[model samples]
Target: MTRPEAPHALAITFFYYRDLPRAMQFYEDIIGLPLAIDQGWCKIYQICPGAHVGLVDETRGMNKWSAQKPVQLCIRVVDVNAWYAYAREHALDGLSELFENDQLGIRAFVFHDPEGYQIEIQSATRAGA
Candidate 1:
């Protein structure tokens, strides 16, 4: 069968949390993402032009909160150093030293959110990376 027609408009990745308000605050105040959509039980924040992340209340959401998070959220930015500095200043949980990956052509670091979700911030180090 042929692929479906029509281009996708936007993309969103949802993460469930026991405390929706706290998660919302972290994404809004700490991560500096603006709220795009606000459903009573879920809040969607815009990460960039077309990318978003949704914060959901575990009790009411499709998935329940779990301590073992097997997934990570990665975001590519123009200045990884600046972001790293911000992370350090905030004393973010599970903060890691910034490092370079030549194979990936990126300078990156990672930190955990309030509920232990790993978030990676990276910047391309070479052209077309």
Candidate 2:
């Protein structure tokens, strides 16, 4: 028989660089996620209030992408302007300025990690747009 599920969600996952150190820096410094685990060959970074993305050493056959790399992580935030400001303050490479979309209804910017994974930071709404 199957075991009962935990009361809480275990985690939300995202693919990251095969390199552990670079992955840690990208998520922890650039992305601003806290480092939950900093093992020598593996690291896990928390992306949201309760979500984590792990970087492993490819022992589990993970690391490389099969086809096209995954794009877009639509993380929700309390404020759009503040989020935009924070990304600007960091000034990491490939940091796109806030842009609005009528259909999606968000103001968002994009950043790239060491492994060239695209991470989009978005706000639910932008001022005057």
lDDT of all the models against the reference?
A: 0.95, 0.68
Task: Work out how many backbone clashes candidate 2 has.
Answer: 0
- The C-alpha TM-scores of every prediction are 0.97, 0.70
lDDT string for model 2 (31-71, tens) is 67788766655676777657777776654534554335567
TM-score of candidate 1 versus the correct structure, residues matched by position:
0.97
Q: What does the lDDT come to for candidate 2?
A: 0.68
Off by over 4 Å in 1: none
Clashing pairs in 1: none
- Once all C-alphas are superposed, what RMSD does model 2 give against the true structure? 4.0
For residues 1-129, could you state the per-residue lDDT of candidate 1 as single tens digits?
999898989999999999899998999899999999999999999999889999999999999999999999999999999999999999999999999999999999999999999999999999988
Error of 1 at 97 (Å): 0.1
Q: Which segments of model 2 are wrong by more than 4 Å?
A: 1-8, 38-40, 59-68, 126-129
